[model samples]
Target: MSYVITQTCCNDASCVAVCPVNCIHPSPDEPEFATAEMLHIDPKTCIDCGACADACPVEAILPDDKLDPSQMRFAEINAAWYEDHPAPEGWKPLVPTPAPPRDRGTLRVAIVGAGPAACYAAQELLERSEVEVEMFDRLPTPFGLVRAGVAPDHPGTKAVTESFEWSFRREEFALHLATEVGRDITHAELLEHHHAVIYATGASSDRRLGVAGEDLPGSHAATEFVAWYNGHPDYADRTFDLSGERAVIVGNGNVALDVARILTMDVDELARTDIADHALTALRKSNIREVVLLGRRGPAQAAYSNPEFLALGDLTGVDVVVDDADLELDPVSARAVEEDAATALRVRLASEYAGRPVRPGHRRIVFRYLAAPSELLGDDHVTGVR
Candidate 1:
């Protein structure tokens, strides 16, 4: 009855902290967690206590016998990790950290931004029985990126906010929504009210490529597109030129993959999710059939994780395209691919995509390695990328 972590694993490591037997591998403390697509359970060591299943915010953990046919492979996938790196001997469960002595009065903590980080910080502070928490955010709603950055089609990932529910309901916790720290209230005011102020606000800005024509009307950042589709109030009215037959994304990271997937996604499939009505309406009329992702590095150094790249292959009516020549790795990268398990998997997946035969009617997500966008070719709006 050992549990298996499945495809919806969000990599938040919520399960890792709760497992009493320490069966979850590549934990947040482990070096591999940085690149691990998902956490896996060690079948031999798991006591089947069900703590991980209960702690999983996405409901991605389940008993082996209960797995649906499509998920049965994950059971084998869980065990295979042990073949290469066996579990350490005499592993003990994690012990809870002892709370600090409460010598003073109630420990009041003001957390800025009600995102996942803020919620987790509140959780830690609330553990001290004498602590009180106040969370502030500019938006009336909370959960920051989870609410505004995660793609709607993946509802499983969004379910993480459900875990944040208890943090809001705690009697010791108070929320101040629709209030900006710098404008509505000052940081000095917050400091006066609370003993300590924790700024859990995440990054909202997109980095510039500093290339020519990147500021054209048709050019936009991936963050803008993510917010627009997720119905973030800041970008609700944002629009993309999907009338074009092809769109070129300038990065190969997960967010770039997400943008490509959204561009080529079937309108009917996207309609089933909580996609913004405006974006959905626009998508219904979209003509985009190919999204060519540009990466300055070779396939071995592609920024996307394996799970996301693999999931792209499973998208209906979409083709994952990779040119064969772009896969040729230089000697340095070739050695890295051979020596690094993660790099090997990335190259192997790219090879698989390149080997696939194209389906004419399906939309394409073409991978272009060793390429950079020097200029956005257009008069005012983006017409082509150079």
Candidate 2:
């Protein structure tokens, strides 16, 4: 049996460079490399060498025999990509990179955020003998998005945070929680102690809707919604008005999908994850039954990856709907699917969703294309969306 790439794969192609057998699809040289969501390994060609698993930054690859029950589905998912063509023989092996000499003197580096990027940076520096790394975060916790942004139901994806724990336990690393660069500490102070400073502070603020009535009680940024559910201290006191039956999200991106999923997910399922207590209570009482995702472009131009789009289909007790009128691609989009593998996959899935009969489900998500929010339609609170 071969290894499988799971949902945590971010399409960085790090595995492709290390694979000796060239079993991974959508290599860096391919046009679809940019458009593809995740790389797949041909089961027949993969020699079960485990090189790809070792090289994956997110720890998304797992040997078929060792897969957790939740991730067993990926074995078939990976094999399906190369079903038509048979595997070839004579695979090359990968040579591991040797650690550099420890002649260099102790070098101190400061990283401003404890997000995925910063943790990876700390991991790389800790690989060297003489490096001392300091990670600082204002929230008093590490693993930024893994702790605060990822949906609670996505336990498999969130498990990637465990890889960072390895770096945190290293003797060469120190974690400074509840510290702010401009508040608790000064830039000059860090420069005096550390040789280099790295800022991995992720997008902390949300992009504003920039329309009238945006400040209404019912309206909110998708970022806050995600943070609130994930138990971010800053948004712990915040609340969303879920009394309304219908909710409209102005974007078709992954974050938008996350918020929609949280709003509509089964309260029992969410209870199994690490979602905040307050958020779980609020979600249980939520009256929302319909979520409309408005995209400025057609279905072919969706901003989310194929995996995210496919997950919507797999969601239980939720009906996924795509208007047939919204799926009619123009000439430019038609050519894009022909040339881009990712676009082709997204369009194909969305097209299939359009044909699916709208069975009665507890909640429904409607994907509407070629529409942009002009203004929020409400008086004191959001009564409706225009």
Candidate 3:
């Protein structure tokens, strides 16, 4: 049995560092690293050390002996990739280089918001000579939406924040918690104190779904749902109604998939993670099973990646259904979409569900296209959405 690298692998390459046998292909420095869908472990070369499994952020790596039935396909996929191209003889595993010693200088930079962008920018600046970085956030916690917006179970994506914590401890970078730019410290004030002020504040508002009944009790934006489950302090008190047997999501982006996963995932599975206490309790009572992901355009134009779509399909006890009619390619766009990786994923999704009817107790994801939502029909409490 060989270790299998599954869908949640985000190309972070943490596993590549720990693998003693160097069985994991496409290390971050490799040419194929960017294009590879996910990391693959060479079955024949693998010594089954299990170090890759420990380093995996999303628990995407599975030991040969512990392979779940759904994950067994990954072993074949991993081994097949290597069959075509053999490993180089006398290959030495690539290792990450240590950073040079920090330069001692006094340039003050103020970063607004603690999201990925801000944290990354700060890390870059701190690498320079004598830079003093001051990071501010409206929330009391420092890591921004990585802690507040990402789904709790998406530990892989969430692990990106670890780099931020390392930057914060550099002594030159100071974190100002619970500091709002406009309310607590004006932009002018920040400018006065720092040589350069970087506004890393991400988009705070959601694009409103203009259809009628969007304000109904059952209606929710993916942002709110994601934030609520991820333990955003602002949305800690908010609640969602997942009592309906079916749900309709307005977008086909990654956020839509995140919401669908949270909604359809077994309550017990989600409860074991760091998901918010309130959100977990609500999920336990959730009756929702089917989620119809309504895309305004064809599958070829979908905004999400193929891996996310594949992960949705591989989820246990959940059946993701696509609409074949919507996936029908226009002659002009077909050739272009077939070559694009992201679009190709959409094409595959369409091909997978050519003529399947949605069944009860299954989490169905409908990829609808060409139809703009004119209105959402529901009164007082949303009874039936149109």
Better of 2 and 3 by TM-score: 2
Which should have the higher lDDT, number 1 or number 3?
1
Tens digit per residue, CA lDDT, model 2, 218-309:
89888888889999998999988888899999999998888889888888998998999999999999999999999988888888776677
lDDT of each: 0.87, 0.84, 0.76
Model 3 CA deviation exceeding 4 Å by range: 1-6, 9-105, 353-360
Tell me how candidate 2 scores on lDDT: 0.84
* Model 1 misplaced stretches (Cα beyond 4 Å): 47-49, 64-77
User: What ranges in model 2 sit over 4 Å off?
Assistant: 12-20, 25-35, 49-59, 62-104
- Candidate 2: RMSD to truth: 3.3
* Full ranking by lDDT: 1, 2, 3
TM-score of every model? 0.94, 0.88, 0.76
Q: What C-alpha lDDT, on a 0 to 100 scale, does residue 11 get in candidate 1?
A: 83
TM-score of 2: 0.88
lDDT of 3 at 36: 74
